[model samples]
Every structure is written in structure tokens, then in C-alpha cells.
Target: MHYDGVDYDAGMVIGAELKNGKVSTQIGFSVQTFIVYNPANGKMELMFIIKNGQVFLRTIFIDKGTIEELLIGSVIQSKNYQAGNTGFKIDGETGIAEFNRLVINKDFKIIGDASKIVLDNTGLAVYSTSGGVIKLSRRP
Candidate 1:
């Protein structure tokens, strides 16, 4: 992963596969964090997580996602800040991306698999046989 900002630029790539004979399968993925901007406590200005320049894991905080706690990131990104609502409770800690929309299973591994599943990039809902729809934000 690599990052470039006003202060500095950095990136790294570790090419190695996870190996284990103890378990039949293992789960793995690459994680990267950027200091591009700051959100409030329990939040951070989300840059995005993209794989292969197609999908975009968004970082925008919904207004209803906790107005007070979200305003900080908004301000950092030159958005309006409603400082009066500072009493609003924060939802969770920083570095926590909303993965609730992702779908994974024994057969459909999110990482370390070569299977080609339907990935909807047009912000349209794509449903699996089990009827769970994946609705991701459009590419940035």
C-alpha cells in the first residue's frame, strides 16, 4: 500500500502468501491506513480502499451517522461543522470501516481466491442466491 499527502508520501508491498497445514483454509487481506485527514473521535476522514482501481470503499460519514462526531471529518474536508451538536454520541472507534455490506462464505472467500463473483460497481444492488445484496458506493 502507498500514500501521498502534503506532509509526506509512503507505500509498501509485502508479497507473501499465508501458509498453514493445520487448517484447511485461512482468511487474509491487506490493510492500509492513511493520515490524509482526520475525522472526529471514533471516526476518521475516510480516503477510500480500492482494489484494482475499480471498487471504492467510501469514507464519508453520514449526517445521521452521528452529526456531532462526524462534523470533524467534514470540517477537515472543508465541509460545514455543526459545533453546537457536540453532545452527540460517537458510534465506534477509529479505523473501523463498515464491512457490513460485504458478503463472504466458505465457498466465496473475500481474500485469497481466484473465483470471479459478480461485483456491482454502479451503486446498484447485486444479490446472491441467498438474497444478500451488496450495495457499494460508486467509484470516486
Candidate 2:
């Protein structure tokens, strides 16, 4: 995963690793794009508001046991494709994974402790603790 100034090999990169806890989504005037974790269901979710002021469900996954064992799928509603599809899976416990961008260029990144996550929605009572970067590449 490569973003800003971080470059992670795609082959060994494991997707977001959310602990079993409720996570929050970023909020702001502009499109609030961030990777969140839902502790209630023990799943990680990517939250984003599109350019047209539309909120859509992006990527979701459940941490299996190891980093490589995690499974995730994306629910995207785009002009080209509008539907939920199974996403790629990481093959290693820890290495480098590509940023699962929501849109074509809107990449979300989180990086820190092996288990340090930022709180998104307070009402949801979600907490995140992991370290990884998300790079959003704007589409032309």
C-alpha cells in the first residue's frame, strides 16, 4: 500500500485489521472519507461520501484470525458498476496490500500501531487500533 509518502508492496499487504469493536466514520463539510471498524459485527468498513453528496457503503471485511486470513468485499454504486462484489484477499499475515479505494481516486489510508485505530462515530461506539496507510487517487 502506497500513499502520501509511504510505499507498501501490494503482494504481501494485508487489508485493514479492525479489532472487535465499534468504530466511527469521519465527518466534515467535505466528503468524509475514512476507514472505520464496526465492533458490533466484528467487521471493518470503509465510509465515504461521494462528490454528489451521497453516502455509500464501500468495503467491508471480517478479521478471521491472521492478517492473511482476512476476507473482505466491496459494495459500490458507480456509473459503470453498481453492485456488491467479492474483493481480493491477502495471502500473507503481514506484508503489503493495495489501497481498496472507494471511488476511482478517493483513497483512504490509516497508519500507526499494529493495533491503533481512530474513532469515527461516537454514537456507534466504535474504536480502531491498527496501522496502515490508505491512498486515494483522484480519477480524471
Candidate 3:
């Protein structure tokens, strides 16, 4: 498989990626939690959060054709979806896949050592041999 890379710094590029399936999403405020793994300079951080957002997917996998359907279907059936809190509702059907602007308040995180996450709540957490444990709990 050939992988071309583009680093995105905003949510709008999410849809743009659907067009090419070769992009990354990065935003400052969007990051809720992160962990660092390497300690040499603590440059490796794994993020764990995507809140009030959208999911634009395009995949050609050997197992399941478009994983987008699976993911969207799961979100639709989630308890939060049932509760009417999920931000995204099916807007319309695309010839390739169904599209939705997911705006739920969800969270998760990772850092130097990685971590567990929960969202709609916002906070920051980090685990590193140099820093030990540094965190800021979520707020309503």
C-alpha cells in the first residue's frame, strides 16, 4: 500500500482527508489528554480525544469494505446516541458512504506511557519517567 502524508491543523481538513484518505488532524484546543512514551526528549505523545467533531472515513480493507459504516453505525447505537447527546446525526447519504458531523462531547487520551480516557469532560494528563504523573481533571 502507498501512503502519502499530510498534516492537518484543523477540523475542516477532516473532510478534505475523506477526499484523499491521506491526512492527519491536529488542533490545539481539541487535544484533551496525551501521554509521552520516549523520555529522551519527551517528544513522542499519544493523543486520546476527539470531541464535538466529525468522522470522515474512506477505507478499502480486506475484511470489511468501508469501516466508516461500522463506526458510524456504532455511534448511532451508542448509549450516548440513544440519549440524544451525540453531536452528529445522519445528514445525508453519500454514494460512497453515509456522512455525519459528529459533535458529541467525548474524550480519551495517551502520552509517554499511554492511558485510559473518557470524554465530554476535558482535561490533560501525562505519564513520563521524568514527570511522573501530571494531570488536570475534566470539568462540566
TM of each candidate vs. truth: 0.15, 0.15, 0.17
Q: Could you tell me the lDDT of residue 104 within candidate 3?
A: 21
1-140, model 3: which lDDT tens digit per residue? 23467553422223223336566555444333322344456555333333346422333236546455453432232223322223222322331211122322236322222222222224443333333544577555
lDDT of 3 at 65: 60
Which is superior by TM-score, 2 or 3? 3
Cα error, residue 122 of model 2, in Å, equals: 54
Cα lDDT tens digits, model 1, 1-140, are 23464444344554545556443444444434322434766676665555554445455555655344433442131133222211112223342222222335778555422122232334444345455555766777
Report the poorest 10 consecutive residues by lDDT, candidate 1.
Answer: 81-90
**lDDT score of model 2?**
0.34
Ranking by lDDT: 1, 2, 3
lDDT tens per residue, model 2, 43-75? 554454344554456654646655655344532
Compare the candidates by lDDT and give the number of the best one. 1
| Local distance difference test scores for all models | 0.39, 0.34, 0.34
Where model 1 places Cα greater than 4 Å from the true spot, the runs are 1-103, 106-116, 120-126
- Could you tell which candidate, 1 or 2, scores higher by lDDT? 1
Candidate order, TM-score descending: 3, 1, 2
